[model samples]
Target: MNQENNIVTRLGLCQRIEQLPQVDIGHYPTPLEPCPRLSEALGGPRIYIKREDCSGVAFGGNKIRQLTFTIGEAIHQNADTIVHGATTQSNHCRQAAAVAAQLGLKCYLRLSRDHKSLVQGNLLLDHLAGADVELVDAPFGPELDLVKYALADKLRSDGLRPYVIAAPQSTALAAVAFSWCIAEIHKQQQEMGIEADLIYAGSAGGTQAGLILGSKALGMKLQPVGVAPIYWEDKIDRIRQAANNAAKLLNLDFQIADDEISNTDAYIGQAYGVLTPECIQALKIVAQMEGIFLDPVYTSKAFAGLIDHIRKGKISSDQTVIFLHTGGTPALFAYNQELTDVPI
Candidate 1:
């Protein structure tokens, strides 16, 4: 619609979000820092990094944004424990554990046995945050979610109220949280006197969903490109559903269509959590050029895709782009063997 209408719509969405149960966890309006060196190196668009890594939670990451609502819902339900599951190096679990500790609730993380032998990265932080960590036989997606559900049920049997962060309701809340993140970015973009042409992030679901929903809601022209770090057959559908679910939650009239979602599975490499050569190079370049660290598993892969697009002339120099750094720098320590061979 018109500019005035767009502003009113965004404000209404924010009002609806504020009415929902939420906890104050992450540092808000994370700095939208310019990446001039990175832009120069690519010889591409003016680039900025949305410092979600500087979110000021445990070690900070995108999960902190989602956890504010997830954990808040847990507290609202009078949950004494929070149950979550993912890969061993899961940034979400690490942040969840920290938020749980901050809110004085017990946290149980049932991570897949992938990389279970090493306690270097997120798993180490999970423990440090006092979460009861368990390495399970399940894989990182649906299988791990089932394990979390069972754990939640068992907790209830023990007369303890437990909230599963991966539940459908909680995931929807996460999408709503990220939609608010879009609002923050829009305000920051206005302050900086430039509108971003594209926003890039590593996404399997909620983050991208929120980006799409938020853009549609605000009538912003920028496109959010989600570079998948993991392969999922229903990923696009999942994102669409999440956005729609979030819209419903906010009592919004619009829906996210399949055509509105932009994502790519090309950068995922061999599989989830498996680092590729491109990822290593991207990580090293960003670190050396901008003094920014991207985790091996997620952001590195997405940034690699962005770099490739710039090199291929897919993204023009005149455009402004924002790379969402969904922090997992701690995971860098976990990949010591893989990263040791790569030159700086």
Candidate 2:
């Protein structure tokens, strides 16, 4: 069958899911495996991990899933240049550059000046991708919108079709991709003879939204728990809405109700980007026990929450807990000082 027809029928299951217009960029069905050691250490139910880190395209991460659809849309829209803004070490920027390179489109990254010196991991890859980096001096609070408007205006005025990859603050397409991930998790779990009781991940809001909708659609009883590394009370709820919206866009009947949306804010320590002691400890434990590397910004902080929940007995000893390894190992190199004495 032709690619168009495959997308239309949503056939080939993994190859084409739900009529998605995606550019084949990242490897699919990222390994979902049982973490025997980590699970045993927690003394809770069985533990599993969705290894998105090994997604196998451009350093791999959860972002690639979303970019498949997003980049395709950009190509479909005839975008010749891709523009995005983020912190110095932005995974989205890295992933966007990889996709743009695959599609032979020009890529430009607008980086915030606040943390430029701490460039490592994804930040290094961002440079390796040879993306035209624009430094913005605007502070973290006011810089985002300023950069957005500036880039959009410049792109429009120059007659260049530029596509901006949505930032962590914007859930537009991120929520959609994660919803697909959640659906896949349900299938993989049933095949393994395991029923997941709870799902945990580091999220800005979009990833959690997708997981919630996907879980609901699968009719799975598992709870989607998002550990926020940033303090945004209503932020995750907005992602839930976006996830439901994405489902609706796909002609699926999924409800993202208030009760179904949930998360814990305990993991957000110090501030948004800074690492904390709990996050540092969680990173080391996961790496040592499971050989999984989580960045301080996202997965590490979220994992801390998972560890706390296990210790507090909020999650029973009989339930299965699955941690979504969103794959920000690139960010590890940037925090060498925090996680010193060994290579991140």
Candidate 3:
């Protein structure tokens, strides 16, 4: 590790990651807390939580880390406006809006869902942040890209240079943000003398990708396990590709193998954003026992999978696990109607 640059050039990643123009948008080294109550509830296999939910940006979330780099790129390019697209209650959109507001850049978000649902949670934050939000007729997919480009073109025509931060294919910059975290986590584990066996989360690929690449580059024994809440099929391959892509961006030789990228889709019951019984139970368990509020969509489902693994003895009684709380607590209100019927 190069102490001066904070880049572990031995792996060839942190150097390039440091070279990128990034701003500090999130509270780093989020608190790592031991979850004794939840651990005993599962009967064994001690569990710890990475509290990214307190990242300290407009309700806090993992997206703030990603935006720190991507938004930095916008400033590096001297862009006056930024554009993004997502579902109605996207944590990413909310964080992007907050970052843009903080940085004094004009921001716009094209959302797929309308605000028929209560104007609360992330949606309300997006509005409060003063982002120019537009409701799109199409769903969030390849089609949304067309609308975003059109909006950017319109902005260009109106004499403003716009930066589009939604790059599904190019995740190197976003991936680098989490890559540094892998090093932070390794240090935390070492300093605390905790030998965690598994580190899991609800992955959209970027976070899992960077961790997978970082684990290999840094030779960490524990790789990331992603609970896919989307892309029910081919999710692992997608994550593998994302890891490789990130490595390419960093000029690193690190490659995440098939088995190295661990994930499961059993908890993605129903569909995206549709709360399941296990999700509700996991949310209730963490909130009631630990006073930690997990969003209904991502962390809850991932934690449910972790719980399922423990209950089925897949995680064994002797092991320790870490659950990455990638924060979407603001989305809880968006699903208040559904959760009201979940029986706590």
Candidate 4:
């Protein structure tokens, strides 16, 4: 992919993406702003944040991008209800509920119970958006997925059309959505006259998958580094498959190779939704330095990984890095008890 070829391919990519059924949900072309103070504090590479936080719709987040296509498909199918599941504080579920409300569709969210389960943060917003919420015994991922499917079935039995948002097909669509996000980032990079060497985000799935697909498709030299918020043994393989699925949707010619996937589970301390000491420190540091808030469950952990790399001198000072702020600031409120002692 030379410069001319990259330009041509990106144009084609944008066209194909536009061809997909989508709803106007999130604010597009999210700002890629320089984090000068954050970079100076880290004493590392030049840092910028892709503000998916400011992506609009129910306080914004990465899920809004995915939901734009996912719910669009629901509307295309004439779905009357949207079913989704994840952990209690899941930004995905929060955004899903909000999007459903915006489009005048009913939403049912089955959230997995966790130690930090509270009627605050995303859960509060979930209810406020008029989503029928249930906190179940199941854990996030496959177990919770089954619950969502059952709910969809029940909805169908009740003579309603339900669309399961976390279904395999919808997950693939999410990856495609994120690939489009990568295209957005690429355009921003070109306009800024700077190219990122690496892009970091909290990922256990499609968000990272799309990053990989988009970077590969655009022939960008940058690597999409996924800092896992949860441990998944087959995360690498899952990301590859998701990326390939997205590529197929976009009519791209390449498949994502295993070697091309870069993800680390080292930052997921204890378990999913458990805040680590490093994560707490990361939240405080970013807030104090940049006046930006990173949610405890995801972005903070990933940012901790980035900070670890910087302090360990893993990234060169000259390299430009983009931290994808996938938004979950609302979760900050839910973690108030835990964050109470952390000094700024």
Candidate 5:
């Protein structure tokens, strides 16, 4: 498809999703700032950072886009309560609690022992926002997922309506918000006269899914790169599934293939939530060079991959690239002890 047709079809996709129930919450068209110093430091492609961090919710994130549709649907269904089961200090759950408070809906969070104590970072924010947080001894598995559902059931037994914002695999509602985001990105890049050969971001699969599907629709040869902050059993498979799920949701007649999905599990070091030396070093580079803060977990890991790719000649010097800054800055405080050795 040509640029005009691409824009038209992209708008059509956006309109179709607009017809679905949604609530307005985020600050749109988040600044796409050039990373000159960081780019010079890497001596690679010119880099631009998509500031999803300024999304303007409980500190903004890529999840705000997802929750706008997710909670919007809950509102459409007249749900009085919201439940989220996740690892301790979940950026998602923290924002969920903030959204519930803003919308006057009850919020419940089930956090595991992954982060040790619940009195810090996003957990503290969740508590202040009046979320009914339960710190359970649940391991990261199906049992924890069930624990969230059980909470919803209990609410139902008490004659209350509850909606569970499960993982992205549970539904394509979150994908809808991000599909709109890709359309926005395309417009921004067009106006800026830039072509992003590779777009890098921390991959949970869902957000990457929407970006790739949206990029495909807009006829941009943009490669959406997924950096595994933590290991998944089958990372690319999950991302491809998310892309297909998005296509199904948008009713777009396109198959998302594996070749279009670019990702790597090489950066996941210790595991989920455990930051590696490369990640910490990357965080310092961005902070020191560009005066921009990056969380120790997701964005740092993805950016570490970006830097490594540049260092390894994976990205050519003349190519244009972008790092999708999915926010998690609050989590930095949670890792104070581990980050103490890194210079401020």
Candidate 6:
């Protein structure tokens, strides 16, 4: 951490986001509560869960923090409509649509034909929000950049001022939201007398970048280990670059060096959206032990990574670990078939 940069200089994304005329849509300082059961299970460190899952949207998850900024950008651009490209169980899409509805913007969702159903979880919430749905049978690629470009083109043809909530692949805005979150975590830890040696969370990469930049900016002592639930090692660099840009947005003068960012591809399991047994077992243990529900796609996988770290002694019992509950609770329902035999 740079001592000179740590001075109370009015620099970084916090300054930039504060400059924006923003509205209050989500709750703040989400509970940083202890998880006794999970801590005991880890057998080494005192484990705490940052309850972003209780963010209180249609179904709360960590996306609310990011959505706050994303929607603010949409409003800033004076977009009358909201457009997004998402997976079938995308919590981002659900929260984006919810924000669009609350802001009185026409919401357009483009999903892959790979969707399994419409009855449960995030897809149901998308319908409940009354978003205009476009199902791209096979022409749409899974890459968000492609979907964003296609949606932008379609919106232009239809004569609507559409705002694609620029995914992390496109901009630093999403990570900027989580950077603010890291600031909050720093404050919360001091208030609670807790020192986290390791912080684990699901990463498409941007979230980790934001956490790392914010921690570095505030000069907090913790390792921001990004457990990649997707296979995009190359994008981690882009994510860090986005964090630097986000730091510029916040007016913070800190830089994220290549060595500062740590990511693990092992947590991803078979592939994106495919649930592994490790994830399944971890999810069940957390729920049964602490009565906390983690969605299969994101949080469970991250938790699995944390557990592996504990088992491998990468993190010791003397250390304190914080697992970020980057809210994907809605996606849990979408994976209902996988959880059928698992007890509540």
Using all chains and alpha carbons, the TM-scores for the candidates as numbered come to 0.96, 0.90, 0.93, 0.96, 0.95, 0.91
User: Roughly what TM-score does model 5 have, to 2 decimal places?
Assistant: 0.95
Screening candidate 2 with a backbone cut-off below 3 angstroms (N, C-alpha, C), the clashing residue pairs are 179-210
Count the clashes in each prediction: 0, 1, 0, 0, 0, 10
Tens digits of per-residue lDDT for model 5 on 172-276?
665666778888888788889887888898876788888877887877767788888767777777778877887777778877888988878889897888878
User: Could you give me the TM-score of model 2 versus the true structure?
Assistant: 0.90
Model 4 lDDT at residue 236: 82
lDDT of 3 by residue, 170-225 (tens): 36655676787777777788779886878888986788888777766776666588
Q: Rate the local accuracy (lDDT) of all candidates.
A: 0.88, 0.76, 0.82, 0.88, 0.84, 0.78
RMSD of each: 1.6, 5.0, 3.1, 1.5, 1.8, 2.7
lDDT of 5 at 199: 87
Ranking by lDDT: 1, 4, 5, 3, 6, 2
> Model 3, clash count?
0
In model 1, what is the error at residue 77, expressed in angstroms? 0.8
Tens-place lDDT per residue, model 6, 44-117, is 78988898888777777777777777777778778798888667777888888898888798998887766554
Question: Which digits, one per residue and each the tens of the lDDT, describe model 1 over residues 1-344?
Answer: 13443533667778988988889998998999999998998899999999999999998999898888888888888899999988888888899999999989999999888654488888899989999999989977788888998989999999999988874676677789889999898888888888899999999799989888888788887789999998889888889889989988888887888999889999998888888999999999999999999999999999999999999998999999999999999999989889878775
lDDT of 4 at 227: 96
Where is the poorest 10-residue window by lDDT in model 6? 1-10
Tell me how far the alpha carbon of residue 309 in candidate 4 is from the true structure, in angstroms, after superposition.
0.7
Summing lDDT over every window of 10 consecutive residues in candidate 2, give the lowest-scoring window: 1-10
In model 4, the clashing pairs are none
